[model samples]
Target chain A: QKEVEQDPGPLSVPEGAIVSLNCTYSNSAFQYFMWYRQYSRKGPELLMYTYSSGNKEDGRFTAQVDKSSKYISLFIRDSQPSDSATYLCATTTSGTYKYIFGTGTRLKVLA
Target chain B: SAVISQKPSRDICQRGTSLTIQCQVDSQVTMMFWYRQQPGQSLTLIATANQGSEATYESGFVIDKFPISRPNLTFSTLTVSNMSPEDSSIYLCSVALASSGNTIYFGEGSWLTVV
Candidate 1:
């Protein structure tokens, strides 16, 4: 099984709607969870990262991690067309640079 | 954030031919990483490049196929040998800054289309 797993979703949502993207991991050693946003033909950009299990908020995006369940989530509020892109969740240990990335969920926020 | 530059941002190459992708960082880093993102797929790490030593590749990746060179702290190169249609993908160079709590950052990837 892959260490990190996520739904490969082309989820379509209306503008200003709330969007939730999630991932699950099996590695208990993972202590850092991150969310990345990537546009077509572009590289993944780090949106937000949280240490261990907790919630971190930045602007309209919130990242939540439940270490007990080994699940992570990213919530987007007031979504816009400009927010249409692929969202990827990555996990890693605290001291390592090697990160395990999920398959990413494609989102299209319609105007 | 460290500024990263990749050369030959886009390329179309014939099968059996090899192409080298260059990654240049504005600042020196202790470790450099090479990742591959296949069409519609997530990023997969190819290898870890550290200066003064050979690269350590991940599973399913071999040094013979994806040779890497880290000659210095700020620059590295990955050469895709014997390219095939399946080898077409975006190659990205990344770094983690310890000063920034080990946040990983990526460069604008080099898009390759193997013909």
Candidate 2:
């Protein structure tokens, strides 16, 4: 099994709809969870990263990690067309610079 | 996030030719990394470029084919040697900042089209 797995979603949703993007990890050592947004032809920008577990809220975005289930999620509330992009989840273990990234889920929020 | 610049934003090269991609950061950093993203694939890490030392390459990646150079803290390069069509992809350079649990910062990327 891949260490980190995510559905490569070409998910389309109407604007103002809630969008949920998720990833599952098999490694128990992963402690840092991150969300990144990448637009076509552009580099990924870090959206948010949470240490440990639980939900972190920033504006209309929330990142939730359930270490027990090894699942993580990013929720976009009131999504806009500007929010259309690929969402990537990444994580790292103790004392390592190598972060395993999931195959990004492509999202399109249409107006 | 740290600011980064990559040269030759996009290029189309012929088979058997080599392309060297350059990365420069605004401030000094300790760790530099290279990643490749093929169409419809995740970002696969190629290597960690260490200043004044050899780069630590990942599995399926080799120094001969993906030679790396980290002459100083803020600069590094990756050369795709003797390229093939399969080598066409987006090449990105990243820096891991120690302060934020080594949060990675990436360059815009150099788009390579090997034909």
Candidate 3:
């Protein structure tokens, strides 16, 4: 089984809709969770980062981590066409140098 | 955030050839990583490049196929040796300002097409 499992979605949503992206992990050692947005032909940019269980909000983006259940999620509100991109869930141990990434969920916010 | 620049952002290489992708960072960092992103797959770490020493590779990845060079804290190179069609993928250079933070920053990536 893969360490990190994420829904491989080409999920389409109309503008202003709420979009939810999630990932699950089997490792209990993972202490930091991150969400990255990757545009076509471009490198991924960090959207949200959380170290422990709880919720963090930044504008239209919200990141939630459930360390007890080993799950994390990113919710995007008031989605726009500019939000179309691949969302990758990544996790890492506190002191480790490498991060384990999910397969990424492709999202398309239609105008 | 550190600014990373990768040369030959995209390239086409013939089989049995090699391509060296260069990564230059604007600031000094301790650890540099090379990753391969295949279509429809997550990023797989190729190796960890540390200056003044050999790179530490992940399982199933060997130095013979992917030789990495970390000549300094701000620069590194990953050369894909004996390229094949299966070797075609996006090669990314990454670094974390703090190892414990795990806050990684990636380069634009070198998209290589091996034919």
Worst 10 residues of 2 chain B by lDDT: B96-105
Candidate 2 interface CA RMSD, Å: 0.8
Alpha-carbon shift of residue A8 in model 2 (angstroms):
0.9
**What is the i-RMS of every prediction?**
1.1, 0.8, 0.8
**What is the docking quality class of candidate 2?**
medium
Model 3: DockQ score = 0.77
DockQ of each: 0.73, 0.75, 0.77
Task: Give the better candidate number (1 or 3) by DockQ.
Answer: 3
**Local accuracy by lDDT, each model:** 0.93, 0.94, 0.93
Give the lDDT of residue A45 in candidate 2.
90
What tens digits encode model 2's per-residue C-alpha lDDT throughout B43-75? 999999999999999999999999999999999
**What TM-score number comes out for model 3?**
0.97
CAPRI class assigned to model 3: medium
The regions of model 1 sitting more than 4 angstroms off are none
Q: For candidate 1, give the DockQ.
A: 0.73
lDDT tens readout by residue for model 2, A2-105: 99999998999999999999999999999999999999998889898888799999999999999999999999999999999999999988678788999999
Which docking category, incorrect, acceptable, medium or high, applies to candidate 1?
medium
